[model samples]
Target: MPLLDPALWSGKASIGTWTPPTGGTAPVVEPATGDVLDVIGVATAEDVQVAAGRAARAQPAWARLPYTERAAVLRRAGDLFTEHAEEIRQWLIREAGSIPGKASFETVTAAQECYEAAALVSRPLGEVLPSAEPRLSLARRVPAGVVGVIAPFNVPLVLGIRSVAPALALGNAVLLKPDLRTAVSGGVAVMRVFEEAGLPEDVLHLLPGGAATGAALVSAPQVRVISFTGSTAAGRKVGAAAAEHLKRAHLELGGNSALIVLPDADLERAASTAAWGSFFHQGQVCMTTGRHLVHASIADEYVERLAHKAAQLPVGNPDKEEVALGPVIDAGQRDKIHALVTASVDGGARLAAGGTYRDLFYRPTVLTGVTDASPAYAEEVFGPVAPVRTFTDLDEAVALASATPYGLSLGILTADVMRGLELAERIPTGLVHINDQTVNDEAVAPFGGVAGSGTGARFGGAANIEAFTETRWITARSAQAPYPF
Candidate 1:
């Protein structure tokens, strides 16, 4: 699919006569060649208001539909996603700089989520509670009106679509604000699915643009809920804006996840899993294992194995079938990674391997001898940099992992099942994986974080449905009984 073809898509600003943003459209460059893939329209605040209003108007009828009808729509959308997978995958590679394999995985995963959501919505809301008097006390999940979805550029399709699916499945209309960088690809994919599913035209509106558009969406009174996934700073702003209007907000923000390697663990497996988790999507994932806490006895062996694996990762064009690692999202992110690494080195952390930045592509970096004083140990380095630290025992490892204010996800690798179970209970993070890397995310599990990581949970089947809906209880006393209060 050609990027930025005025004929292909109606821009967020207006229907026809759609022009690219006049602020000299920034190039969405392919990370490998620095080639301009497309120019996305930077939407203004007015554009977002229009979209939000449209969605709010369309929500009532959608919410009134039967659960089975909503399920059918979702199923059809999933089928359409499968049919157009190839086209969407290509766009993902070009715009988001995701390797062919990873891009394909993301597209397929999103499609699967649609199908799963359909099944979830089709089930009964809740069973009637048994009561002494003849009364109907049943909990029913009802849509929370129009939900504003602000998606991040990294893992655009999967993370972006996740917010929409559960909300839409529960009969909530959505105003999807995709990141300008990957809007063409992500927006097109969503539009195609909804169109093919025969959903109401205004049920889901795509508002593609930058920060200004997002602010407008959050501020609009029509938006009942705000679902956001991005940087901690941006998330805070969105949350505050939503709070101003007393609107419901769900946020999946930044994380500096840790992977703990116990003394009795298999070094090779832990090393391999950690490498994949830390470098996947150039380590831009909120759940990616950016921190490593290894037992002192096995720290050297684990670090050496991890370095060897990192060195072998195939870094090249995202469109290439064999490429394993792709570029950071843009040059700005590249500079940020460089600055963090330099500071870490200056703070006395030893560079274990791969710490250099080249234009948009940063090498898969690993740092050791990191102290709490260093930013590398404390901050969320959303890059392909893994900071390793040593721990004398399990308590120490757990303590170090919990030191950071953010508690999103953490992984523990060990052979002792008892120890793993015990550690899992003590970890402060929301999700903990034993004998695996932190990247192990199941579609059905409750995926989210605690503390600064953000609020609310996604996935976990029925739990997700409840998150997008509000409950109301009804009582009838036959109109004959006097006031019992």
Candidate 2:
């Protein structure tokens, strides 16, 4: 099937276009070559209200349908995703600055999520309750009415569809506010997929814009839940606003994850994992291993091998087939990554490998001698920069891993799998990987973080459906009895 037109994404509902405020249009640029791909109109606060109202009106009929019907639609959507994976991959590369591998991975993951979400439709919503008396009590899960989804720019297709597929499968109407930059490909493509797959026209709405649009979507009273994935700082505002409105808010936020290499780890395996974890997608992933904590016995050799591997990956336009690490999403992000590297080096951290950039394309960088006092150790660079540190003992290693406020994900590389599992339990992250890289996600896995990283709402399988629904307790009397008020 042919993809939808980009021009169709202008502050629209399923059927008609909403009038945008006098907000000026913004140009969507290809990060690698600094080329303007398209100019998109901004969605105003009014647009959010209109979309949310439409979703609220449409949700009841959708929720009333038998789950099998919903499952059928979702299955077809998944098939559509498989059919157009290559086309979708191209969009991710051009608009999201994703390298070929990363783009392909996202497209496949999205297709998987659609199929995985189909199973959620038939999963038991509530269990039979034990009755205490003649009265029968029961509980069942129902749609939250309208779920407002605000997705980030990085990994937009996977992250955006992650929420939308589940919300729709559970019969909640979705109002998706994709990042302004990826409005056409991420937002419109999703809308078209479901519409073409026989979904109800008003059940899913897409409105694309920047911060004002997102805020409006969050604050709308008609929206029963807000599923947001982005920076921790922005997530706080969304969570707080949802709380104030007494709405259910599910947030999958930032991660300053750590990758730990024990003394017994295979040097070659650890080095390759570290390079892939830190430099993939230029390290913009929430689960990217931001810090590398290695044992003192293997720190020097591991860092050297990691640095050597980082130097070999090609950094260029994602449009090219050979490029492994492309540019950061924009110049501002590039500057921020460069600033963190500069500050870390000036503060006495040793630069072991690449530490420079040409335009938005930053070379994969490796640093050693970084201490807790260094900004690179404390903040999330969200770039292709890895800061390595050595620890003398397991307790110290655990401490270093748990030092960050963000507890999204962690990785441990060790030949001793039992020891790694024991350490994984001690870490305060939501997800842990043994003998693998930190960046891992599947449609069936429960994916989210705790503490500063997120609101403890996982975004796959049953967890996703739960996030977009509410529970109602119903009671009935088998026989009429004298009741006092």
The TM-scores, one per candidate, come to 0.93, 0.97
Error of 1 at 158 (Å): 0.6
Candidate 1, residues 19-46: lDDT per residue as tens digits? 4433334456576677876555566676
Prediction RMSDs, each to the true structure:
2.7, 1.7
For residues 257-304, write the lDDT of model 2, one tens digit per residue: 999999999998889999989998999999888999999998889988
What local lDDT does model 1 show for residue 330?
82
Worst 10 residues of 2 by lDDT: 13-22
Error of 1 at 287 (Å): 1.0
Pairs with backbone N, CA or C atoms under 3 Å apart (clashes), candidate 1: none
